[model samples]
Target: MPSEPAIASAPHLNIVPASVTPLPDAKPRRALKVCLLGYRSAPYGGGQGIYLKYLSKALVEAGHQVDVISGQPYPHLDPRVNLIKMPGMNLFETGLTSIRPHHLTSLTNIYEWMGKLTGAFSEPYCFGRRVLKYLKKHGRHYDIIHDNQCLSYGMLDIQKQGFPLVTTIHHPITSDLKIALSAAKSWTERLLIRRWHSFLIMQRKVARELHHVVTVSERSRMDIADAFDIQPAGISVVLNGIDTYEFRPLPNVIKNPNRVMAAVSSDQPLKGMRYLLEAVAAVVPKYPDLELLLVGTPKEDGESGKLIRELGLAKHIRAVSGISTEDLVRYYNEASVVVVPSIYEGFGLPAGEAMACGTALISTDGGALPEVVGDAAIQVPIRNSKAIAEVLETLLASPAWRDELAAAGRKRIEELFCWTRAAQQMTDYYWQVIQRENG
Candidate 1:
């Protein structure tokens, strides 16, 4: 292998207040040159992709030059921001058969292939190696670099190169590992789960060494500190924002009085889909016509599928995936109630989106959920199907109560969360990091 490239020193730039310039008398903040990094940012992949998409657009709107450097399934960004594609093996999309003789020449490719073969996730680590190589050659172009939860060792290298780096740790992957282990059926399953999460070792080390670590919520700040053994005070909090304009209610969409809706990304153990299915089954005894419209698909042989068969909920559930944003908003508008049954969430995007769509919500008081929903939605205990069922019954029976909750939810989201506000807060933090690095 060739030698590592020399680290570039920080560039000189005037750091001042953010573009919004909240104060009338405040001086004009210079348009910052920003570089955002994401290891795998597909819009439908997860929250990280959504975060990258909206944040970059918002920052550009705030009068800054933003570039997104991502690997595999690059993000959908605004026209103004540049997208620097850094493709990887993408073994998830293209099976192991995609590897060829030419792939063996690159050590990063070999590492990624081997890790995937062994049931380990190697995207973050391989992405780090690629990113380090890219930035080492052109690191001086940006005033600051913000990473979206790809806590790889290469990030530490980037920081060592004298660049001002900030990382957003949405939540600790340790939380997911714990939930998966508890739900495992056998020792072999437990072992496989641990192997898949082996990259956490790199993440924990990098997180501890980084100077500026931020999280989306106070719960995540505390959890990340505990999971990585860092001090809570050292971690900063910046709540995520909802795209209120895109997710708002459409009055023309006719509501289905007997239907409820949820958006689950996958049939993962941590998503708590089984609990929601159980709740739906329990409620079916009362309302025979009750139906659930799930926005994401679940594997036919997965736990959720098996539970649906055992509980006789096959007829009551319908799932649709890969739908456009317009279709998603329309579904949200047509449902009588939206439920977020996550066992845990760093920041509950579904809950916020549901509320923003002017729909009544029922969510478990899992990590940071209450912080997002506040008094607007009905809060239930985690892993309790009976509680969820009782709440559903009460809400479905009372149209007046449902209308009241819906109004409150929309008001709360309008007052507290939005992409514009998130971008402004992030811009201020960027200036803070740059000034500290220069000093």
Candidate 2:
């Protein structure tokens, strides 16, 4: 016979409204789970890869969990962020013009093999299938997915799965195709270039359909809108940021007497390395000791290499690849000036990085180089070798102008291109999308 304890009466609570006021120092909330997607993200050289790495690092630093889902040439991300590797056939690895039977395993792989065999690049579409498969299994883990310019059909499936999707198109690939086609010597070469860039059709479609779109620059936003036939209102411009800590001038390094530095990747025609080489040739007679230091590997047996040999610049031009960021920054510090001979750029990260390191900049008026460099850099016309030569010679001859531009470049970067500012702007944009979706 256990004695029952007397039951206490339940307490009643009343809800009341309080005066609503914004807290002056309250921190903004960020996404708890974020996924960034890319087709190819190699941090060693490519801009997209570098974007994925820094953006993920910045997001993670801002108290958000970020994951990068990428294809071949996997991203180099901060250890805090998870990496989801979605590998493709990577036909570029084959090193041969023809695809062998071993390359065809999955249906997607088969399609890619056939496509490449016929001169049509299928990396985007095949990568889409792989991404779709990955997201089907892992999409539930993310609060939002941010695509890094890999606009593909697979994204549609992820969007349909009730997840918020945002895309960052650094620039349009159509620009690359147009530039390459314009440089093609024969109709067959032009046809091949067009076929290879056929993936633009899919990209255009995906970009138009996606609700939240981010691009690196205002110029890029307009170009993408025009290229993809999308409304400018649907796109948001978030300028890219440079890491000043990694890109700062090295005090111990002495500038090279005749060394001029330029950074570029292998695939893009808009980089304008060819024009830079021609400019180097033009200046070699006046400055016998002059040399060009390219911060990228030359494509093997490619047109670029042939041009370099044809111009007899093998001794004067040095192309180094696969170096650490610290070492690359050292090159920037040791150079007389950093040149950006791009026909077009979405945001011109190289220009920003060079300027960040307190290097004198000489850039062509490519897509957004002028916008990035402002009056801090000497601007030249795109694809004009003579202009590049004249600018280089002028800068080399005038120590006063070089020093002034160098100081201005660094100041501009400090004011406009710091990573902290970029991260804050991106965080705000992320919240805006989330609030709009919830509303």
Candidate 3:
């Protein structure tokens, strides 16, 4: 095996221009080859995968070539976009004990095994190693690499090698760690949670040293600076966009009067699904026929599942997962109102998607939710089940109010949260970084 690459000195990014302005939308200013890096991506990988898919598609439509290099659970990408597969142990998919002697033939595999054995996640680090190897050979072929929150040492090494690198920190992981700690039932459990999130240490180290960084929202930009100890001035904010065409109001599908909906990712406390469940329980007595459509699966015997059983609301809530995007829009259109009970969010994609689908929303003023929802949706305080129930009753009783909110939400998404606009802004920012680096 080769010796580790030296920790390279941080490169300075020349961002501010003196006296040059382009006439509105002048060709590019320029378009260059872009490589997007992700440790994991969708069908099942969640927001990061969705981000990779849409951003690449949008950038390609803008006339730039985009290549996505990703590890396990590879994303479903646009046909126009190129994909380079980087395989890791993906031990999370194949159980850690499944590693064979053949797997330990390489140092990368060895590192992955050791990390997994010790109860740590090694995907980011392993993927970075593979990506660095690829770039060292093909580094000059691309103009820039846009990383989707894979803040590993290899990214820093690539930057030092004079490759123009830009990273997106969706939100600080510290917020997640803090929230999980508060929910832990014991010291041992808290320690285990900390172990799982220990990757943030590497993330923090890489964040401050990177020359250019982008975040999806103003709130995320501020939070990243504080979490990673970097200057906020160095980060640019680009709002994420919804696919308005896909998530449009289904005029033909009749809405459910006694149904409420939320898209949950896990049983984790951060999503605030527990609070939403509690609120459903609070309102069900008033509307005996009410149903909560949860568009996500809970772990078998997981806390979310356990909570539902304990509350005796198992029959009232339906947990569905693995639905297609086309089907998701249908779920949004049918619900009486969508609820975003999350304690926090980086940009609130679910809320944005729901609003795009013309569903009335009741969202807590969690991080960036207020920014994403604006006055277009109903706002409430976080963790207040009574308030949620009250709003639910009001929305269900008054169809006019629901229609009014639905119209405002649809309009807001069209104006503020469309993918084409987001792609355009991102393209401009990409050019800025490329030109600055070349200069």
Backbone clash count, each prediction separately? 0, 0, 0
lDDT agreement with native, every candidate:
0.86, 0.80, 0.84
TM-score of 2: 0.90
Q: Which clashing pairs does model 3 show?
A: none
Candidate 3 residue-wise lDDT, 278-370, digit = tens: 888888888889889988887758888888888778889887887888888999999979999988899889998898998889999888888
Over 273-356, each residue of candidate 1 has an lDDT whose tens digit, in order, gives 888999999999999999999988877888888888899988999999877777888999899999999989999888998988
Pick out the ten consecutive residues of candidate 2 with the lowest summed lDDT: 8-17
Ranking of models by TM-score: 1, 3, 2
Query: Candidate 3, which ten residues in sequence have the lowest lDDT sum?
Result: 1-10
Q: Which stretches of candidate 3 lie over 4 Å from their true place?
A: 1-29
Residue 141 CA error for candidate 3 (Å)? Answer: 1.2
Q: Is candidate 2 or candidate 3 better by TM-score?
A: 3
Using Cα atoms with residue i matched to residue i, what is each candidate's TM-score against the true structure? 0.93, 0.90, 0.93
